[model samples]
Target: MLSLLTDQQALPEPVGPLTMFGPDFPFAYDDWLAHPAGLGRLPEHVLGTEVAVIGGGLSGLVTAHELMKLGLRPVVYEADQLGGRMRSASFEGHPGTVAEMGAMRFPPSATALGHYLDLLGLSTAPFPNPLSPLTPGTVVDLNGESHWARTSAELPTAYREVADAWEKALHEHAELSMMNAAIRRRDVAGIKAIWNRLVPKLDDVSFYGFLSSSPSFASFRHREIFGQVGFGTGGWDTDFPNSMLEILRVVYTGADDDHQRILGGCQQLPLGLWDYSPGRMAHWPEGTSLASLHDGGHRPAVTAIDRVGTGFLVHDKEGVAREYPAAVFAAQNWMLLSKIRCSESLLPGPVWTAVERTHYMGSSKLFVLTDRPFWRDIDPATGRELMSMTLTDRMPRGVYLFDDGPDEPGVMCLSYTWNDDSLKFAALPADERLEVVLGSLAAIYPGVDIRSHVIAPPVTITWENEPYFMGAFKANLPGHYRYQRRLYTHFKQDGHASGHRGFFLAGDDISWTAGFAEGAVTTALNAVWGVLTHLGGTTAAGNPGPGDVFDQIAPVELPED
Candidate 1:
């Protein structure tokens, strides 16, 4: 009973329960990480060898941590800070109030990521998404009209119709129920059976195109409404041009459901891993950790990579060059095309093509620190909360209010927009962005003066403008599944030439489901296994890694012709 809006209260738990087990490449990554047996082992000679890990993001950190545990030295290269997009920018005066610049919300279905959070002893609370039970109330504004509703049943007939149409379309076209059940039970064969069939059929269909073809969404009005206020989250019209297969991947795995935000910010995950020492390590001492190994710092940005004798030569921005037997490139793959100089022999032809073809979505967010939880105040006339989690078709697109306590300062994400909508705010400064969003909110709450509650200047970020991250996240467009497949499968290097075997790819973009931390963690594990195998290592007996069982659970191959 995974409802379109991801209301956990609406459904009872099944036996196994659904996780982010994947509809494509449905391997039990969570189980793999939780197993008592370690991920894998390395040979004695290669134990202390250095392996260059480009990018100090989540993927690179995970790769480095695991490699360190396996007795290999991981030299991590970073262009910016340690926590890549998991940036939490705090107000100048407010101690704990922070605006999540990137990757704010997460779904419980991301079990692989949860494993690390549990390890780090981090806690999560329900995010205040539109219509989520954790939210006090919600406001829906469309076409210069506003409606206040505490639940989905209270919305107008048109909004309810849009919700129902979306559910029906997913059920009829995407095998929603069957896929969910299969994922819950970890039925690998069942997932492959369904996804393999859908991949070929839906690879060329856009998300917008799918809605147009569905009988339940025949009306242009319903389709437009659905895009403006999407289920699980809000305002996914930005994703309309993406492949239907990409949409299916997200929905099938429940990647957008039951969202939560990490307490003390998600940046702590990588930072914690960096400083944490594994209780059991192969060749390294018990107290040795990634932080101790690096002597409290990492190398600068990697500038170039070239082929050496049975290894690779990596050049950093500081003019330092090091040769290693193997390397893992965990940055945005597009960096390989422009920012970083990668030898033509570093990857296969199809993989380089995939890297060049990867499509990323642009996103922008405007946040401000408020004096207090002013939104919780009730109006005398309407008996409604002064303000609520909002979704609209205006420039703001979505507004989420975060309340720590009644006495503590509150944080407001005044606007969160994506794609073309995001680009509209790209040229605006923080103050201008705040003015535009506040103006939009003023129209919805006529008598309420939201600007008066602000205690500090606004904070904003346009992901497309970041030098390290050219865009927010990857979203495959129609017919780009083939390109995605090539990038994802590059970790299994047996098919590639010897020269391409030493270099591996790992990142959310390299995963089937991008924009989720779970993808980042799972792909990092894949690269760890790849690096282990490259050095003539093997997984512990009875604990097969993703690469060990490659032939059986590999992603389905669609004909290029």
Candidate 2:
């Protein structure tokens, strides 16, 4: 969800100070990371021990970095480049200007991820969301008509009606205000109370089902418009089939609000952490960093994994095989079923089934550099910017304008689409995609010549087509709560047999809130806690890790039967 057409009067009563503290498993990962006591202390013998970390993405990096701080030597194996989906592709000869092929906007509620961003000293600017205060203007093109507006109030009454319907539906069925208050206050009891009651009732309900069941959304036209231009981000009709619980998790925690973009690029977070030297660490010497541990680079892709005796044996592409007492698979979960070879004994039957059942959304983004901020030019007749952030029903779906300065090359995301909309452009080459996007935009801005300002070749990515990442991110379907829980809690392997105990899972897909980076960070921390506990480590007194508090604040579980 990336575009929002929110009407201030139509919105629910305001709630303040929200963070991504779970509506499922409510744990303060930010507080845990900030604790001076440190994550945990490994046994003396476990100190300096090698822990194999598969995948060099944000989750993998966070897992490896924390493992290093806990006195364990981490060997990171990346099938692709570092930062995974947090990729920032720079145009030729353009340094700061980049095409954010993956993650771009992030909500302030991603407090766990914010911890690392703050640590890395990375700056953020308000992303130009549709109708957001930061945006100069917005254009909504649907049914072959264009409506330009600077704010929600400027839109036609029908748009406001759709927005109001959504707000009313949320308050009517989802208990939006109660959950918002609970999440804002970080009330574990209140969160669990509301979430537990709703989980069983709504686990099988789809986002569309939730809306259709609401009286306010009774009009099919309202639902259609609401899906095209959602409240917080852009259109999310593609997400209609997802579990209502999933949508609730995001809205409850404010994961879709107040979005910001990393000033330079988000990839810097992982790259910076790779080279960051934490002031306090256990067994490693001062100034030790993940980059230094790996000779400033990491091993090639992992080809296979085998449970050899009590430990696991990992084989890399370069024929390098290493053994580790414990390992973390932080890559896309689908990789285990597709790209990598793994022993059946590595995980239990149910956990493997959960992995097989994971559902992912396909996404594609196309970006091109322009000569200048031509969009800022005023249209003499209309007194509006020549171009504005766009949301449409056409093939392009969503278009965003990024202005660096009048003299600097500006960036434009010609298209940002998901699911069926994304699949339409997946097979097309970058040039063809650009042509289609330009064609769509031309219809919206009849007089404007968008392609004339282009300064570089278009760059595009289709996550579903990427060999390493088969899909953009996980999105649970109706009746998938059980499967989601299995993957998320797999890190806590104490209940598992000895063979499955040493192997761990981390990444957004393994989290309750799948698409957000906060999920990636928190899940990696969970794996860190799991690896620590597996190696006879204990959290500092008075600072219990997630595993320590598992029984007290575990995610609500539904009966298998």
Candidate 3:
């Protein structure tokens, strides 16, 4: 330990507020969207031209919605319901209390998503993450030992040690404070200079390795404890072994913590964009929205995408086909192989490898509506809620509480697990899964009576089991930095070797940062720029997108073999 009495000092403090987007591209698009000059408008000639958007999720919907504003028609295609991973299911009778089946939390710094939230007139409150400001208290159960605390200060010594070490690691080792300051100022040169230096060092390193190298976590015990109870975003055990870059992007961006959720559900953002009437529009009559163009409906799921002449032909699930001048694929990258019949010519070998190898992290959530905030009833001896927002080193990794009020029904996420933990329940039925979760919770809180108060059956989903979404979101693995570089830069130019111009790709997977909605919105915006540019439109001199200035501010692209 560096206990030098001669040069001694206290731990260094974090420099600035949180405002990062991803590992690279630190310039905030949230600031760009707020600028007086808007995203570039399409040239007059291409105003009414039709572009096909495959997928109706947040990415696809945002693509279509923005195209309308720039004077283009987007024919959206979807196989299932509109909100892909943003599904919100309400208890049969209690419409007021609903369960967020997917994408429950939103980070405050996700201003790209916030732009839509503000425009849609949606309201949000602090999400009740374990040990988060919104939660009155938190309960951490590890190795059959339960610790209850409102803050890390209130937890046991070991927990406090882990928390303090993480804070120091982020500030000194990860350079979180400096990067955050640059991002806040939208300092393109400064952010790139700092982030580019980090890429080579962190790219091939495992997140666990990154932590182990830090002075504060030199031993396995500290690293192990840190993984079991990561400060922000719950247990990071799943991502501990992933690429350090993945962990850096997550922790740096506000995605991992200080989150909020739409009052009703996060799905409303996409659903709201569907019918959103743009204050300004192009080529259409006075009032226009993605909904009005599609007659308030989306085309069937696209089964195949083949290049026809210079354009692309997309076939629906029923084999119904349509042709468009250009196409923006907004679905998960895996869909290109398993679900959609992709043309080999559409993507050359390298890009196809990037798409095929894009790793997705699986996730599962079990939700149940209770008669009331049953956990709120305090125990005289413990002086805490029956259970704190629970996080355990057990089968059910993280548990969240959504308290509507004491009078109204409250929803509790009995279990939210990721990766292999989620895969374990892939074969389990809803009832069986519920039993497994309740058993896990019962083990975590031995004396707590959680079952008798159940008001209705639980809602459970393992995203990996769902055919449409093979996994939760992209969790880039070690040495996959090149793949992300390839995926994100593919849309910037049309003249690739494959003669595959006008076929743009946009989604969370294609963004610099994966998993978060900010990435989804960023990629969608990139595709919009690609679409407009492909249709002979040019960005205004004042407003240039990431694609417009990709060269100077481009993140460190790993050298190809």
Candidate 4:
């Protein structure tokens, strides 16, 4: 493995170099170059088939798997490697251990997740919990003094007034949920009522704006906590605006799972699928040349489709084309937009703009290997563990530690979310960013002297720079409520000339819990239901309604609206 830092001399040497080969390498640039003659490297002819699914991420794979069970042999056209963002990195020193750089854990509420696991014949294990007595808390550097910041407690005395104002806002928009239900059922009057209420709010006013301008509003200190807990910030002036009720709805209604980290890592899920499918599954190399489609009726159609379709052509970066009766576009929304050449524009201007421009959080993980469980010493005064000292703002937010050490051995993975432009880091010499990350680690854990005890070089996965995945996961900006609606409505198979018939959209983007494993699973289940409907199959078989698997799990009650 290439040493990211120049101070390698200061650190212990590794046994071997790190290799970056994986099933998930980006395939856009190379796959487009390997098309067969007379095919234009794109799907030129329209072929009739049962189904063709494009993009091989979780969404696409799950959809195809569901279709097969429904008696349809769906062809999956994946551009790069399978598993999409769920790529794992190999470290030389850790023989059996793998570091996951994408899609870490799944929530229990996602029935599809459990079903998919069973289908793959994989079992679940509780996420590693060493039970260190450290209570995780956010600390802010205030005038060089580290002060604990608790969102709800840190609010000023006047916060209640702001909360009251937010309550009133909720009452005024009390009919919003009804409007949403109406839109879901395609009720014209209901949709009209919603548009009437929402249009006035869209004029120069953002969600943040409404919150701040409200008589009861205050600072974002406490508001941010709500946001972190999946609640919308009650700030009116913020670009990502929503009623306080909507915020509460997210907090109360979203899926919850105490389990973290799959037993062998997330790769087990896909590996199980491959094992189950065996000869039926194929892992194509990037840039493989595709066969030509001669008859328009028999030929596959290459178009960016959100809905699952009967027949389509998929052209990979290698110029290889595969004709399938149905295709699932399972990659990120923006990435799919670039690959499929739609005959007519399905996504409208504003909706497409939101999909392409919505800022997503960037994620990077730092894996540290130690000879033993060294951070066991707890600080009795603050109830914080020695490992907890490693939390700092200089790097990313939500940094977590895993026990990948020997005997009690485990991996300590720290995650960071980038707030600024990632292009700035990509522009810098690679060594510079490495130096910054190392410096931050040094600040967090001064005792171990990572420079000396390091077993392997740090592995970094920059979600922002990745070609197929432009960013880590979806995060709606202030005043972008319409974007969420658009994600659901604009991609449906609603008889639009540009829209795909039977082609369905699924992934973290379309579901309510955007940027989570549960969202991906939920979207996949939804897509499966659509596929079943098209095949004259019962929805009950494809979608085992809510409370089927999770009813046994205890309910978690959050602050009620």
Residue 176 CA error for candidate 4 (Å)? 15
Residue lDDT tens for model 3, 1-561: 011001112535535445545458654577667766677777787888889999899999999988888888999998898888888988767777789888888888787888988999999999887766568888888888888777666777766677667768777877876776666556677777888888887789888887888898876777777777876667788887689888777766656776888898888889999988888777788778888898887899888999988889999977788889889999888999899898887776788999988888899988988888888888888776787788888888888888878887878898898988888888898889888888988877778877787888888899988898899898888898998888988788755753768888898889867777888888898888888888888777877777777777677877887
lDDT of 3 at 124: 94
RMSD of each: 1.3, 1.7, 3.6, 14.2
- Per-residue lDDT tens digits for candidate 4, residues 258-338, read 344576668667544533442222222222111111111122323443232444455544555655544455667776556
The predicted structure with the larger lDDT, 3 or 4, is 3
User: How does candidate 2 fare on TM-score?
Assistant: 0.98
Residue pairs in candidate 3 whose N, alpha carbon or C atoms collide under 3 angstroms: none
* Cα lDDT tens digits for candidate 2, 407-452: 8888999899999999999999999999998888888988999888
Q: State in Å the error of residue 357, model 1.
A: 0.4
Clashes of 1: 0
Per TM-score, what order, best first? 1, 2, 3, 4
Report the C-alpha lDDT of model 1 over 1-561, residue by residue, as the tens digit: 334343344544775866889788988988889888889888898889999999888999999999998899999999999988888888878757788899889988899999889988998999988888778899989999898887888888888788888888988989998998899889999999999989999999999999999999999999988898888887678899999998888888877777999887888888999999989898898899888889999999999999887899999988999999999999997899999887899988888899999999999999989899898999998998999999999999999999889998889998999989899999999999988888888889888988888999889999999998999999999999889988888899987778779898999999988999999999999999999999999998879999988899988898877
lDDT for model 1, on a 0 to 1 scale? 0.89
Local distance difference test scores for all models: 0.89, 0.90, 0.81, 0.46
Estimate TM-scores for all models.
0.98, 0.98, 0.95, 0.64
Model 1 TM-score? 0.98
Backbone clash numbers for all candidates listed: 0, 4, 0, 66
